[model samples]
Target: MAPRPPQQKVVTLTDPKAIRALAHPARQRVIDELYGGSVLTATEAARLCGLTPSAMSYHLRALEKWGIVVRDEAGEDARERPWRAAAKDLRIDHSGHGAATTAATRAFAATFVAPLVEELLAWAGSDRRGQLDGTSMSRGRMWLTTEEAKALVDQVVALMAPYEERTAADHPEGAAQFSSFWSLMRRPEGSAAD
Candidate 1:
């Protein structure tokens, strides 16, 4: 068979309505499931998410309406339609709106973070401690100038570029899913030192 087409990378949110559509949890779950190059039917997705088939179908439709996912016509079965994510990265520009925008952005961030938290917890609980053993983990407060802060963010983004490019390939079989979560928050000027 011919190779599958490369997945599209999210550039910008041209439509605010699409962003709003993805604000729902169930729809976000659908997006996450289809992220790692998985083409799944609504029934299959529902079973994975522990939801009724009809309910999962509804969310899948919402995702399709938002241009976040597309249906695969190659699948022969009409009863089970395969779906894939529309983009590899979800880009949301928060420079426009006020309070509502902030809330929406937070909701979007939470949608992605929740799954990672669960996965990390599961890994910690597993008997195979070797995976996490000898791992280097660090958490601390840092004080940096405005320019320095921007440089730090750029460095982190550059570090993750290679891994992001790998998932774009057609990996049909089971493979390890790795994710790196980076968060940076700076205090206002004159804030108390730690």
Candidate 2:
């Protein structure tokens, strides 16, 4: 038999309605749970987000309509249906939207990212001797032309392929999932600090 096709890893959301729907705090939490490889039922998502099952069902339906998540047939039965993330990453372009979309996008990102930021800070504050080895965070700034910026993103995405392809079974002993967050952008005018 032929080799299986590679999965679509990133999905771009261009509709403002869809973006707004995804900006809900509880919905983002449900998406997070699914993205972390848990095939979750509405009840499970509800529990994770501290919402009623009916409420989570509504949010999951909205997410499903936007193609952010899909039913996992393999993990479902008559009693319950499970949902999984449609892709490994979701992208929203904020270039041309008005204040509302920008605000919604910011709300979505802030709610989604706050936990990760807290996690990093906790890791940083822990005693080095008792903390996990080989974990790190780095920051830098550089000026580049628009074309060069696009090329840099392309290169990094290519580098991520191998790590993205691995399954839980492929993970080595003592290995755990690591979250890598990156931000690249032009400095705003009148910025004083580098």
Candidate 3:
């Protein structure tokens, strides 16, 4: 296969309301399932996640209220309302959420990270583990001016763009769901010259 193109940074909402809306585990799973090209009814989604139909319905309603998922009007069944994700990818702006992290936010982050760790372990057990062969994994200190830091982030984002776009479609039949979490943090202790 040919190489994928660079990704475009597309983060629609930078508001606390949107971030809080997606903080729930059930809602996040709904987003994941729908993003995989499955416009499913409440019952179908509930079965997929082992949730009760009524519980799934409540979560679906919450997602709809937040404009993250929308009813699939193109479907024919009136009793069964199918839904799809509003965006193919979501980027949460943590800047305005406030300095102090709430228990709810921390819990949500832990829930999200747990599944990711599980998947990485499972992936390592499989034969395709060699796919990470050429990939580099390391941490190091860096000193960069404001412009240089921004440019570096842009470059990394660009490189990951195409893979992000094709992530859902690239999975084979009966493949387990995989989640990718990308984050960049800057500490105050380090100066630009550091």
Best candidate (score: lDDT): 2
Tell me, by TM-score, which candidate is best: 2
Q: After superposition, which runs of candidate 2 have C-alpha atoms over 4 Å from their true positions?
A: 1-7, 74-76, 125-132
Stretches of candidate 1 exceeding 4 Å from the true structure: 1-3, 14-17, 130-137, 140-162, 165-175, 184-194
Q: Write the per-residue lDDT of candidate 3 for residues 109-155, one digit (tens) a residue.
A: 77667766776787679787777544334556666777888798789
Expressed as tens digits, the lDDT of each residue in 81-187 for candidate 1 is 67877776656665666666666666676776787688678767888656654444456789788799889977986786666555534434665565555667776
Candidate 3 deviant stretches above 4 angstroms: 1-11, 97-105, 124-141, 167-179, 188-194
RMSD (Å) of each candidate, 1 decimal:
4.0, 3.7, 5.8
Ten-residue segment with the worst summed lDDT in candidate 3? 1-10
Q: What TM-score, computed on C-alpha atoms, does each candidate reach? A: 0.70, 0.80, 0.68
TM-score winner between 2 and 3, please give it.
2
**Worst 10-residue stretch by lDDT in candidate 2?**
1-10
Cα deviation of 189, candidate 1, in Å: 5.9
- Clash pairs, model 3 backbone: 7-161
